[model samples]
Target: MSLAEAPFVGNASARRVHGFAAGSTALLVGDPADGSHLAEAVAELGLVPQSVSGGSAGDVLARLAREAAALATSGAAVPLTVFAADLRVSAVALLDLVDRPSARTSVAIAGPHEIAKDPSAFTLIRVERTQRLVHSVGSARHVVSAPNALAVGALLVAPEDVPAAAQLWAAAADDPWVDPALDPFDLALVALVRGGVSVSSVPLGPYDVRRGAGVTVGAAGSPWQQRLYGASRGDDGFFSTFAVRPLSRRLTAFGLAHGWSPNVVTVTSLGLGVLAALLTATESRAAWVAAAVLLLSALVVDCVDGEIARFSRRFSALGAWLDAVGDRVKEYALLAAVAWVSVRRGEPAWLLATTAMALTTMRHLEDGAYMDRTATSRSHLVPDRLDLGPARDLGPADAPTSLPGAVSRRASAVSWAKRVAHMPIAERYLVLALGLLTGSTQVVLWAITLTVAGALVWSQGGRTVKALLGSDGYERDARRVDGRWSDLDHETDLGPLARGAGRIAPLPFTASVVGVGMVAVCAWFIDTGRLPRVAVVLAVLAALVVGAGCRPSIEHRLGWQVPAALWGAESLLVLGVAATLPGGGQWCAYAYLAAVAWHRYDVLYRLRDTGSPSASWVTAVTLGVDGRWVLLAFLVATGASMQSALAWAAVLLTLVYGAESAAHWRAWLGREGALRSEVARREAEV
Candidate 1:
């Protein structure tokens, strides 16, 4: 007889010959070939195999228990044999079954048989204890019911077991299931049953398989599987992604060595900024140099603080908060220094200082309020518990106490507007240079000191106010109520408004031509003693104001508002020089001519904000745009103007401004071309 048609008599005959019970159950465990033989022996002894298949270890154990339960409920005899592919399957299912006392237990070994010169052998063996309790007439019927009943009954089981049972039924009911279509779990289940072993427990732990004679079973740990698991953790080194430079590294190291926390660095920078302001108040040239150095040092230290935090992994919410407070202090100090200089020089000081303070404060307040509102709105929309503070703050030390504090911290941490105002290198240097040039060094130094004092007050004042009010009082104050400035307006853009003033931008071609012509005509007329000085001043101011108003959009985009204000200042300065002219029309004529040339140059070269331009470029352009022509005109008109070294200093500024402007133009053009090329490439690809 062929192996398939051979009587399944090996384990079955042993049980029968030994007078064991036909329904006794036994668990089968051995090599696949040996297990097949045991299965055939069990079948020969008149027992049946029940099988279940699944993908995961958890799923497999669940399926095995479900199949075992089904078999027991089907009225199978007390002794049943369970065949498992590996120890892992058997262990998992055995533990599960032990937990559920209702599951029936059995063991059997199904081993391969050789017949008709082929290895398509199957064996089933029954336990030798219970065969006499069975009747011969009903044995065939029990065997026939095994496959069909298990398949149909599995459908009535719990939803979780349905998928595994369905897989088993599919394989048994069709030949295609045994082909390449069969998964590893399905194949193992089918092979166990065919080897005459009754499957009870699912495969759980590692399985070892030998592919050739004298070959050892492969180890349990698979490299590919381990990698897949490890990759899920998602860790990447910092340098690979951030590309931090050596200078940043050195700065970070320095800060760490000095025991300087980011917050401390931020505070120290503010202090230095105050020193720069004080320098501006001095008439001495040495004071200006000192102020410049201090400001530059502050900028460097400011950069180092952040780098240190990132490098040392010591970032904190409090540090960030202090940093922001320090930034405001520095800004106010610089501006105040300028005002002090103006005041000492007999200019209107209080008005300028107050205006600067109010504008800066309001802008920051608006920015903070807007961010808080936006975050609150988003939180309401998304149902997630988002902690928007520093990564460290989310831990036990700062577990959120109240909804408002949590929201406030998050809002403060992520407000982009606050960061934008102070971080750029160009901005810090600009403030430094402006402070040095506009006022005496002592004025600058005093401004810096005052700024630091103000910052300390603002920062500490809020907490003091909150403490006096108590928690309930603070909460009441924190409550939001509708007010003005909440509404968005089209004119909210800051850049273009600043640039519309000629002081922040290059003069338009028409303006340049007209300015040149008017200066020439005024100079010639003054030489003849026929020019009107007041008319010249009024006419020039009117032209500048009108010109500035015409290109509001461009000014807004470029952040030229300050430059525009400076233009108004220039006109006033020119008027002052003209009024002081000794020869009346003759000498005053030079002042008018100089004003036109200087204004034109200012419009063309004054540093305009190009949305985060490089520090080098900003500095270069700023220094290049000189007002020497205007100063020369002032000297010629006043007649009594000093020829001291200090007078020559003004002339030097003109040359610097010119050089900076030329360099900036070159860089801007290159950047523009690169951007255009990138756009073209993207379009082509599309």
Candidate 2:
């Protein structure tokens, strides 16, 4: 029988209380005679329970292989949480430990006494430090003698490793000394270790509830639920933790009880943020106070969406993208509104607002690029340099300094202080709200600029130095970065002539940077009307033509920085061009920048998730970077009608990029939902 049709004996209400999403699978492995209780426990934890009878080692291996294949074919991307029927553990504990799906393999670990109860059934593995590297797996007594011994009571097979697990088991079936009942867990542990998979250990001591005979959950008020809440409160800004979470967590719990999805909470938060921005533009004491309150309220709701996702293990890629983009939209909208109010009061605040927006965007681009590069290039088993202690050396004579020992303590205030240095969304939002409330637009704008500038220099500057001096393979990392940033498909956008010319004289990285720099300078001169229109048109055209053909071929070790440099240049060009216009023209420039920013961030998210950027047509319509520069030249040439030209450009860019991007992502989401539904349907059938 399929696991879904298996006999379940646990209290039916228990199934409703377990908050995991539908379609999870759990396997009960033990003698056929005693598997009923295990199946009952799995059912109680809201998973489809299947039983695998103990037999000869070869037979067990065959059965496991078949089950793994079935799960794989059924589109079960979530890992299979396998439990030993002999294990006397609380179902609540097991569910709490393994409900959150992860790519890494995790095993439920028990104390020596618990292992002693089923010594032959357990596989003891040695784990060192928090990294949880399993070096050896064997008989319980032999392996448990080592320090940090984790006795495996359960096994988790990540979907990607499902086939490997099946093959490893089939291969081990012929081992002469393999005990089917005792060594299946050992063989699985060995497979994970040999495959270089990091093993996470979920210790069961705190959650264990074997009081004499009957299983029981933790003390009154469900400690597991409390732990879930705590885990969901992840490391946010210090202000968020101290000021926002206490209320947000309660609201999250209320939402969870009422069956609210993360996406719903996200929409609510977005509305509040937008409303707050609109109110901020009213330019009055009452409106400012109301805006500040609403902004903070919006942040609280924002925290709820993420917390709900974590608490219920209902994460979605679309939800993540929306949350990230939502924050950017809210912050930018607030800045623009403040700038508008300042302008209404007869002040030139667009410059400061533009600086803040451009600086923030540059920081985000650099951060994302650096993170993507490092993650893709990482292939080692050692701790990252930032995680190591001072005694750990990265390389001779030029090693970067590690976090101090005090910072390693999980509960230390120093650790919290260290996180605060990152200046996360919570901190940034608080700064913006406070500045808006105080009625000093320039002061708040400068505060944000200086703070972000300082944080960027502190973070990226150190990382650049470390990347250069570390013993890790910097060349490989640089190549990955280059591929990520320079993988843009500009041929279609550049037209046939430009594409053909690119073959003969493609711009090198250094020349492209210089060319973009020249364009920015000339654009500024043109916008301010400091140069004759004919001279401006000629110089801009010359600068644009330098990169009008192809993308930069970056081969330098520091080519990753080239994108940020180009982005900075683009900001200068846009701001300078916008400055030439009068009243509403500035908002049009901001709108154009916003559209471009959305596309840029969309590219980053898509590249990170799918390993590809938006489609070629999208780039063509938006006018790829080279096309944009050429277009700017034309706009400069229309010196008398600059305002009308700029307005049309902004409107066209927004409509084309925004509409196409929304349509693209909507189609993607629809496909994803359909796949998920198919998987769930298959699970139900099984």
Candidate 3:
């Protein structure tokens, strides 16, 4: 029989069911006297509660196994969270810690005072510096004198681990180290450890627990709001932290008070950004000042959207995707506007503009590629994993007991310096604003290019070190360009010639550099009536770089970043060639490339999040990167009307990509149930 049809003997029922929007069930097994109150609180938090108080851990597990099996048929992945009656953990801490996307099977660590009050009632957990659990012990008395490990209580079993957890609980009774005095909470902790569960510990902080009362939620106080305001993303630059974010927090509060969704705020920001770009294109002093104001305002609102999402705890793939896309569109639109204003002033700002865009795109590509490639490796933040014997009190009183604590302390000291070196979006945008205020598009573009180039060198140097140092997940197979890679969509259009040429090199860095060199030479000679020859070289180079058939691989540590750089170089060449054309085709080129960049970014974000890029047909319609270069080379060489051709291409690309991207996101939102379920679940927890 199917799991849904299976019989369950457990005395489990939804004691208090909220809306189906918050349909997940929380299994409660704690002090029998506190069961009803706990159930009520949990229900109020939008979870269905099932109390199974006063049972051996094995007994509770047997029932859980049966019920969990039956519930599996429903297809909603609901975790089983076991709460300890005496643990006064707030919902904010619990959700933030346990509900993270990367979180594994986890247990809450009891505070020192709680462990001191009743040492026997908890399981001592010792972990390596990487926070990987190394040892755990529990009994009626102390397992080891003056244990150098944190005490573990409460357990959260992820959906996939529920069955294994049940089996482990049942087998715990047979273990020689099992203590008869252990309660369900302690027993479950021991069972999970002894069963070799890769458990992580969440240390309870002062804010996580109440002083005297039971569960004084931090979110209700002003201090919690302050904490949220200060919880900036690690990569946030100095200007963002000192100016944008502080202003954003007040706007975030206003947004929340007005019941505005994060997406609404994002749209508002996008509108402001578009307006700023339009004003910048006017090339007047008054317009420049207004544009700067609008751009800065847009940045502040951009921050507010994210802050609202974090503070309200309403998150979704759509919101994240929109925010990312909006940023790119705003930045690029403003960049093109800057170029337009410069050309009108009889200044040769095209080169500077293209250079700036290319550098910025390259930086973003590296950031995305390196981050995605090393995400798993960086999660632990350690070069080596230590698997030492049982932890003991071996050092002097002042010596540090936790290696992670020491690492964190050291890292905090250098974090500000590192952020300054990165020169993030806030700094880049500020530079543009400052240059505009000075009424010099050429100066601003040059400044942006130089700053970005320097930042890229710093950032890429660090990434190269990490990749070469044999970081976890930076192995050969992981770095290989495969179907998971979206940057080289042109490969599919190239056929076997491209494939063979790619295999000859197989290193993306080599291909990217060579392709870029070929394009640069083409751009240089295009104005000298060598367009046909340049187009031929471009075709051959494109074929070699985007070789199809074979699974081309980049053996180098920095291979994944090559595709992005190559793509940016291609865009630079396109813009450069258009600037030299007659009848002001540069604007048309910018519009075309902007549409093209949007599609590429769509492919990028989709691949990052969903493991699938845009459809192959879409690539064909847009002429892929290879096709676009060949066509542009042909048109310029044939003396065709460059303006009309570019304008049409821009219109066509915009319509196709815009429609397809919208359809895809709309479909994705529907499949995800518009994030209603997640919103409901997190609302109560936050």
Could you give candidate 1's per-residue lDDT for residues 187-242 as a string of tens digits? 33333333233333211112122211211222223421221121111121222112
Q: Rank the models by TM-score, top first.
A: 3, 2, 1
Candidate 1 matches the true fold with a TM-score of: 0.28
Task: Please state every model's RMSD to the true fold in angstroms.
Answer: 30.5, 7.8, 8.3
lDDT of 2 at 49: 78
Query: Where is model 1 more than 4 Å wrong at Cα?
Result: 1-249, 383-429, 432-686
Model 2 ranges with Cα > 4 A deviation = 1-39, 45-80, 84-153, 158-163, 170-187, 195-220, 227-233, 379-415, 470-502, 527-556, 581-585, 609-612, 679-686
| Each prediction's TM-score versus the true structure | 0.28, 0.75, 0.75
Stretch of 10 with least lDDT, candidate 1:
132-141
Instruction: Count clashing residue pairs per candidate.
Output: 101, 0, 3
Candidate number achieving the greatest TM-score relative to the actual structure: 3
